[model samples]
Target: MFKRLILVLLFLALVFGGIGYWKYRQFQQMTAQLTAPRPPATIASVEAKRESWQPTLRSVGSLVAANGIAVTNEVAGIVQEITFESGQRVEEGAVLLRFEDSVERATLESLRADRQLAQAQYKRAAELIPKQAVSKSEFDIAKATFDAAQARVAEQEAVIRKKTVRAPFSGLLGIRQVDTGEFLQVGTPIVELQALNPLYVDYALPERNFRELAVGQEVQLRMDAYPGEAFSGRVSAIDARVDEGTRSISVRATVPNPDGRLRPGMFAEVQTLLPQRDDVVSVPRTAISYNTYGDFAYVIAKGENDALTVQRRQVTTGRVREGWVEIMKGLDAGETVVRAGLVKLRDGQPVTIDNSVELKDAEVGKQ
Candidate 1:
């Protein structure tokens, strides 16, 4: 019985040993495959090039009419007529509203009649004085009466004119605030008037850029109301003082609105074009990798065995124009950068350039 048990144990041990050896051989093969060097990753590359770059200062702004105001009545009166319709464009001195001026008109007429009588008396007195029929003191008294009557007439005429409200300038009118027969007091708002053409845009810029900003600098604007469209203008005025709280300077630009598509109070994105620079180097925006640490890109460098290797480079980026970005520093002209396949890249990793797709600065700008 003991000999039979020994034979069973030997068989079991041999069977287990064979299974372990097979597992060890499989592990060796897998490790060898995992340790082998991988082929170079295929990537698209673009050469950094020098281009004419126009540096821009971006800001948020609001559109304002060059001339805008709330039309108001200067005197209190019952509104007899509203000559302007809501949203109507009117010219300067155009009668917008008329009050009940009948009483004032009658008063003016009566004063004029008295002045006419006084004028005739003054003339007869002058003639009589020359003929020695009237005393000099009587002539002086007649002249004073005539002057007083004329002054009263002039005052009545002014009161009559005040009853009529005229537009101060050519502009578009808002909805009427007062209707016909509605009474309005002095300084009561009638309507809002805005000059749409040549609209003004008010924006602010950091005080650091104050030296670069000046009147007549070109500006590009975009508004959410008008998507996919761009408006342009030139700087018209700069504030004399910087804002103490924000350390920014106020700037105003005038944009032509011949079509009148732009309206006041619209929010706008403003880009103030600075002077053109010829020394700026630019690259395709796709080549840059943005992270919380900073911006970086992978530059292609020569490697051994005629192979191309990627070296991670830190870059300082500036304004982005279209699909390209201005490389402010850490990159030189003529250096090749990986435009795509950035995720698989590592420092000093080998790469194969597939020039099948070439990215040019002009082409990126068109995007």
Candidate 2:
């Protein structure tokens, strides 16, 4: 009975061990399949080329109206009539506001009548002096009196003219500050008038660049209001003297804003174009990848049997132009850079070049 029990135990152990070995073999096969090599990934690429790109100096600026002023009254009076509504466009010499001028008008009429009487008296005095009917001193007094009356009339006319406010120049008006029947004191603001077309952009640059700046240098502006659109103009004026306090020079650029879309006081990014274009290795902006490590780009590496692979290369980038970025370092002209279709790309991984999309990018470069 003891021998039969030991035999039964040995048989059971052998059966269980065979089942464990089969399971181990199955796991090994699954692991081998999971570790199989993958096919090469297809990607679109572009060739970095040395191209002529315009160089520019960058700065922040604000838009200014070519002509801007707070329309004010010179003489005090009640606002009788506002010929223009709020935010109205007016031409030069256009009547904007008028004050009650009844008292001034009446005074002017009286002065005119008195001036006529003085002229007649002066004429009579001159004739009598020639005939010896009046002394020289008497004629002189008569001439002085006539001149005083004429001066009074001229002064009254000027006072009447001040009652009516006219536009000093053609411009668009801001909100009305005074209502009808409101009394406005001297120098009280009526409205803000700004010439919208041909705006001026005011910016400052370091005094070191003074030697490089010129009156006709081209300037471009980018505003927050309008994205992807650039307003360009020529440098109209440069400040006569550099500011001693800030050690900077103020620059003014005149931009043609025919549609009047650009308003005064809008903040903008300014770029002044240099006279010469620079030869740089330029690639599409998409080719660059920015990460915590650093900026990098994928470059195509050709291998044996015409096989293609990608090498992740660290690059130093510079300013961006129309649609390309300047490669300052770690890149060379005429090298292929992966512009798109990066999927699970590793260092030295096999890749297939698909020029279908790359051809479109080349066409855009021509544009």
Candidate 3:
């Protein structure tokens, strides 16, 4: 029994020894991997240089019609004729609709006949009063009768005019709202009218930029419908007060849209260029490494024998335009910065510059 126990102990010792030897070999392999030399990373790079950049403010604007309205009838009447078609362009005071007014027309003629008779009587009374043939009270009565008849005629004419609807101003009309023979009540809509040659753009900017805003400043506009086409406008008005809730000031600009391509209620991207231009150090937007702590970029430094190494730099970025960014601080003009392969880079990491891809990317950005 003692001999069997010794054999079991020997087997246990061999098992543990083999396990320890395997673990030691694994440790040595990991140590070698940790101390291995890293290879140089190939990255695209570009040189930062002085660029003339204009500071611009960007916002989304809503297009509005300079003059827009829903045309409505002022009086109740039965529609007899529609003179204007849907979507027609009409001039001011042009006839748009005609309401049934046979009764009003007949009334007007009857009043006119009564006015003529009263006028004859008034004239005869005037002649008699001059000769003392008629008393003053009788002559006054005749004058009053003539005046009442004339007023009745004028009143009937006004009623007839109200039955006919005309365009209040020259503009394009929307779809026809009322059909011929349809009864319309007072304040019933007839159609929508809008002047389309010129449009107003309404947008707001932060109150901090209020001092930079002024009337007559040029504005640039872009819309998805017209890709690559930019619309120009001028700042027409600015609100007197800033909104308390948003801390923004309202602004209005007038854009000429002669072709009527820009319709009201369309959204557009608006950019306002400041009066001053800045000479700033500019770099490609791709070169920026945005992080939660801070924004940074990798700048290449030349070492002995012209070996390139990347130095991580924190940057204060300003306005960006056309795939480029303005570097406000932490970098200088004429410095080379790594433009690509940023994910595999660190501070003081060896890198090799490859401009073949970088040059092609720059040309594409320009286009």
Best by lDDT: 1
Give each model's whole-structure lDDT: 0.90, 0.89, 0.88
Enumerate residue pairs that collide in model 3: none
TM-score, candidate number 1: 0.79
User: Across residues 1-367, which tens digit of lDDT does each residue of candidate 1 receive?
Assistant: 9999999999999999999999999999999898877678888999999989888999999999989999887789999988989999999999999999988888888999999999999999999997989999999999999999999999888888889899999989999888889988899999999999999999999999999998999999999998989999999999999999999999999999998999999999999999999988999898888657688888999877778998888899988988899999989999999997666568888898886755444332111
Rank by TM-score (best first): 3, 1, 2
Better structure of 2 and 3 per lDDT: 2
Stretches off by above 4 angstroms in model 3 are 1-37, 117-148, 356-367
What lDDT is obtained when candidate 2 is compared to the true structure? 0.89
Model 2 alpha-carbon drift over 4 Å, by segment: 1-48, 276-278, 282-332, 335-367
Error of 1 at 22 (Å): 16
Error of 2 at 278 (Å): 5.4
lDDT of 3: 0.88
> Clash number for every model?
0, 0, 0
By summed lDDT, the worst window of 10 consecutive residues in model 2 runs over: 358-367
Pairs in steric clash, model 1: none
RMSD of each: 5.5, 7.3, 4.5
- Residue 196 of candidate 2: its Cα lDDT? 92
